[model samples]
Target: MHRIAILLSTLCCAVTLMAQPALPPVFAQTDAARMRADAITRFYLAPVRVMQSHGATRPEVLTRITNGQTELGRNGMCLLSNAEGDTASITLDYGRELHGGLRLTLGSSSRPEPSLVRIRFGESVQECMSDTRNTKPCVGYSTDDHAKRDIVVEIPRDGQMEIGNTGFRFVRIDLLRTGVTVAIKEAAAIFRYRDLPYVGSFSCSDSRLDSIWLTGAYTVQLCMQEFLWDGIKRDRLVWIGDMHPEVATINAVFGYSDVVPSSLDFACSEFPLPRWLNNIPAYSLWYLIIQHDWWMHHADRALLERHRDYITQLVDQIDLTVDSVGRFRANVFLDWPSSADKAGVRIGVQALTVWSMDAAAKLCRILGDSAREDKCRAVARRISSHIATPKKLRQAAALMVIAGCMDAGDMAERYMHGIDGFSTFYGYYMLEALAMAGRYDDAFDAISRYWGGMLDLGATTFWEDYDPAWGSNANRIDEIGDPARKNVHGDFGAYCYPGFRGSLCHGWASGPTAWLSRHVLGFEVVQPGCRTLRIRPHLGHLDWAEGSYPTPYGAVKVRHERTAGGHIKTTILAKPRGVKVITDR
Candidate 1:
């Protein structure tokens, strides 16, 4: 019944607004739809007015709805009253000024249901007093020297006040000595306020649900005014903490080693994982590259220059271990390499590390710090040269490079051979890395030939393993029918071990999809100041995907759509600012 009433009311308001083209009558309009329309109109129509008033001998100033023909905070206040409605709210902008201290009083000559009136700072809304249902006041929030009320009072319909109640009459506010500042749409609204040494009134009303006023502007303005330096500082802090936790006491070593500080002893070592997996310090090195990429985006020159040496030294050690043919033997045993024969060098580690080194080099150039540029160039040359060699290990290295393990490339000829690729989760790993490097063409090929073939079957998400011909065991291995060597079990499929395969439906993978839809296809709409938005369409070959993320400014929606010609068109809609639409891309 309530939903039906709301729909009918909305229809009536639409008719009313459509029939007559005039500024809305603020009071007589009782229908909620008309109220909403009025609110929207007020949002776009008003020529924002800023008022500034000051006490002649004090540091205080008055701003917002002031009398005396001077926009001063003194003697300036807004009047909100209605004779027949349940509630009344008024919206005003105090600009950048902090209203130091003030008092709000209710006049006796007003007719409303309840004698009690609610006064709320910020945006205002209206309610019907005819409905007796009401909620209790909210709990209080405490700051250093003040405990401001966080509740608003509801005005009762037909109650009387000394001030005239409209739809039919006039009302006024009397402001005493108070300090305030006002500016008109100069920037986005920052809910942040200055630290006042003294106490001040702060409150919010529930009526805002029915009225939409300065809320949009406030959110929009805040995001537009964000400082770039903050991003750089945050990424830097995360990197430093991850690299130098207090538990890892050694500073001389690039990362945690099996022994303390060096290979001398284990008493003060920073090995957090198991002893057998002791050489896994590469994980921290991987994290450093990710953080450095963010820092580079914000152009943190000093941090980039300072840390470039450390990152370079670390990469140097790993690179030196690679043989003349460009393969590093695995000393760590934990990672699955050659069916639990842990000593065999794993291709995944080298691939990931090379990618990190390439990124560090790219960042150095971006910072314009050429100190490590030559070294990076030399490494890239050596890696390329080594991959070109005909040795089997070099061929694997070449495959990793072509698959975005080192620098991103568009080579489709190299793929891990028939049986091993699917069982190892290498398909997902390669797909993600290649996508990261923007090698969409090559990535799509591998996906279509391998992973997509499995998705076409009845699989809901990705699985750990996939075999082109699982039922057919005609091909012989070692001339013996060993069940362990046969790929008949579901767990033994290639997709099983890979984290990305299967319908895992996790947040981490979803984040990557959002990035692709938002950045690659680039259909997200951007409002100048508002933080929230609707999303554009995203098209990919998989089953439907959806992601909603929160930013400092507001929320964002990313969606995808897959089409012919290997095309994907994405749409991004914003509910707030911080989710930026990269216009240049």
Candidate 2:
């Protein structure tokens, strides 16, 4: 009788608990709004313009391409008719960068013979028009790595075929062979992206800066795939160091995103201790900094706790590389620009190591690992004694400033001058170091001038690497029909990205978006979890600026304007609940 009563009691309690609503986990963890494969929504969009057409390429096909949709009583198909040994092709400009593939709905063909089709997806008109194959005549650094932009396939007499799930702004479809006419009922670029609201925003007196800001944000937006990728066009992998600026921008814009933490955790899992991230020394160190940067904004202890074992071991492993005097024992590699400069590369790595240690110390303190915390701080102190003079490399100079091995104002004057040695990857740090010196105006101009240079060339998104000199004689990627002009997409880049293999839509280059939000609006997360914020508007040359910053609680709206007397005015348009806003006028 006693056993029966106890069993009934347990059953009753279970039933009661089951009746309640679903509750979050006990630990304070950010909701990993996991996007499953089914969550991938496709937006089929038609091309805006027929960039080029050859050999019976009819313009009326654009309307009939969408099944059963015809402007007139014409046949419901894009007649891709070609002659023997000759090809008929049409290049369509979608007008922007897309992350998905092309979907071609096919109708009945004129002949029983299967028509051969060649599809080329390009980030530019130059890329789409050029042939990219090992045996092809047109060759250089143009490769289909991470994405198969160039492809050849056969179209059935009655069915459709789609090719590519890559980044592109243009699509060129060619109908190959004779005695066969292929009718493409529809040709649509399948645009896939996470359906997330952009809680963060920025606007200013300068329209150019505003365009750059939004463009940068959109660049990172497309990169938020299964993982936070370095680029959508190429190098579509979770590069830890490359994800820093991306994470910062995500925090400032999206407020909180599952992709950030999940990507970090994924990188930690993909490469354990004794293995550097992306097989680069500094990238492993970047993982440490990413943790702190995310924790400060999201404050998800549960997510941080998930990487407890990995984080501790990684930091400990990094500590072993440092000697008593602060030099790194491991191979020092920072970025492509300074890769040749062995001395500069070593200094950059040392500074990055120190910067990582500082970040690790904080992370360990949060995880209650006091022993590792002390060890990180001790190593940081030892490295601080060593000074880094990054003369020509802006990447190294910026790292040195953040690592406290160099002064910001001095570093700016010595290394960074008029877009000299400006890299899209480390550009944010240079901007941050400038902000550290309170030279917000110069930073503002740097964004306008350097990033503006890309905008001037009709770039919808930023590139993996850029040189202002490239634009001196380069034709805009969108300004098609000038074969004699210099092709920016095909002509520049070095290291991993050479010539046409260069990624035109790189997430690492989206630093200006985060820089504008952090420095111009001056929205600093002074405390972890965004419990407090410090907004000190540095309008610089701008007469006024307004923006919204995302917080865990809610989005904070702010506007700043300069008075005629030169006195700056700041007004808090809106504040989230439980978030304290402190203004530094």
Candidate 3:
């Protein structure tokens, strides 16, 4: 009953059932709607609040930072002007998580020499407030790896210094000098981002859904720096597996950015076969899937053609690993939670292989390699024959459904039962699986409750790992660590992102954005390169919704409103050209 209808670029209905669905959501409020920002740019933001100040002559010194006064000397704010030996520190809240560093403009110091200071960048207020101490497995801790969250630097007298080069919303500055007083000209957040246009967008009658869509878009946008990183704070690398949802988000919003293809290219070169992408067997499957999804969106064969040899070879290599039976013998580590369940992992891995092989067969056919296509189809059929039980695990079950090895309705029921425990990485598939079963309400509610939970936690960007139950006794990320309340950011994480090391802005968690765009606004690519689309509106609860779908021709703006008689009145705001759009009237 729910399909997010998108506007058609109307041309001709040339494609059929072989087509795939579109993805995710984005509403940059006004900025996203108006794509003005450069591909990669920076914006300076001043502190909204001064959390702490020690040994300060002027109590309101740093508080005046909101004025954005970068004037050197004169009545400029003096953060710390201590004659006696005292630990002078000032913590600032930039109000939101951003991908950049801190910039401090020094007016003039009492001493002619440079003044040494320690800068700590944190995704959470609690993380920025603390030093690199008390790091344990389960307990939270801070470090300066990949991107420097903590660093010590010197500010030359009457000069400017930009320090951090990571993702952070809070900054802690500690003065290490006794007699020297440093006057700050300006201290602002150097907000860095790509100048790319927010090509795709989604906004419903619900504000919560709007924010969730925006947050997911912004999260992926932040991760789209030099490459499509998994997270900005941690796991700051081009992880092939994590890029699946990210690529979907890119398709939904940014539309054909080089980051996706470049990162995919990097994944191919960086983690070549035999090693498997990221040394994980499943990640290799993700690589193929990414190519397929990218093909569906931009329909650029250059990527497929560039990695032509590798694609065929990878499929061949995968075939060698399979035995006479369709059972994938590899211990497919799907995700941390799914991996814990070995049997579930077996189901997920087998289905995922079939899914990837399906993509490979199509890709091979496009490349006009019928021999390879036939081989891929045979392999997929064999894998499809051996279906392992999902063991009620939602991720595995979702994977099974997506691969056509399991019934979507059965998996959708299991998915709702354990709504709290969904893999951010695989949540996209779960939503897709739910939609496949015609459970649009289930998918919609899932996206709202789960993805919206992050927004409720005062998250400007999504986290690497999340559990709705975690917010029960958890402190908001914006707030300082309250001993009375649970340390939300500092504590409560498992596997790779444990404790303070957990990334608050992971792109993998941004699946809901794309999910909303595809299922809710419904601009599915039934043909490669959006040659043909099936536009359906699945607005379950919302009265009205409107958004644009990014396509090769241009943005197709579509709107859906509920009539008094409980019927949807659909309208195509923009005119079409080369593409065909199919709708259920």
lDDT of 3 by residue, 75-153 (tens): 7466576567677888888877888898777776788889988889999888887657524434567766578788888
Error of 2 at 81 (Å): 1.7
lDDT of each: 0.30, 0.81, 0.80
| Candidates sorted by TM-score, best first | 2, 3, 1
Measured by TM-score, how close is model 3 to the native structure? Answer: 0.90
Q: 257 in model 3: Cα distance from truth in Å? A: 0.6
Sorted on lDDT, best first, the list reads 2, 3, 1
In model 1, which regions exceed 4 Å deviation? 1-269, 272-288, 293-313, 319-353, 362-370, 389-410, 413-420, 423-425, 433-555, 558-571, 575-580, 583-585
Q: Estimate the overall C-alpha local distance difference test score of candidate 3.
A: 0.80
Q: Give the per-residue lDDT digits (tens) of candidate 1, residues 215-318.
A: 21111111111110001101111112122111111110011111111111121133322321124544433444543533422234454465555555555555
- Which of candidates 1 and 3 reaches a greater lDDT? 3
Q: Give the winner by lDDT: 1 or 2.
A: 2
Task: Note the clash tally of each candidate.
Answer: 69, 2, 22
- Residue 329 shift from truth in candidate 3, angstroms: 3.0
How well is each residue in 1-585 modelled by candidate 2, as lDDT tens digits? Answer: 223224334644554465344445762435445423443445677888888877644654663335423232125556777667878888888868888998877667776767778899888888888767543223243678878888888877666566798999898888877766766667888887655566788888888888888888878888988778999888889999899889888898787888888888788778776798878878989888989988999898988889888889988887888888888998888778778989888888888888999999999999999999999998888888865586577777788888888888888777766667778988888888888777887888889888889888878888888888888777787867466767887777788776678888888888989988888898998899999999987888999999899999999999999998998899999997899999977
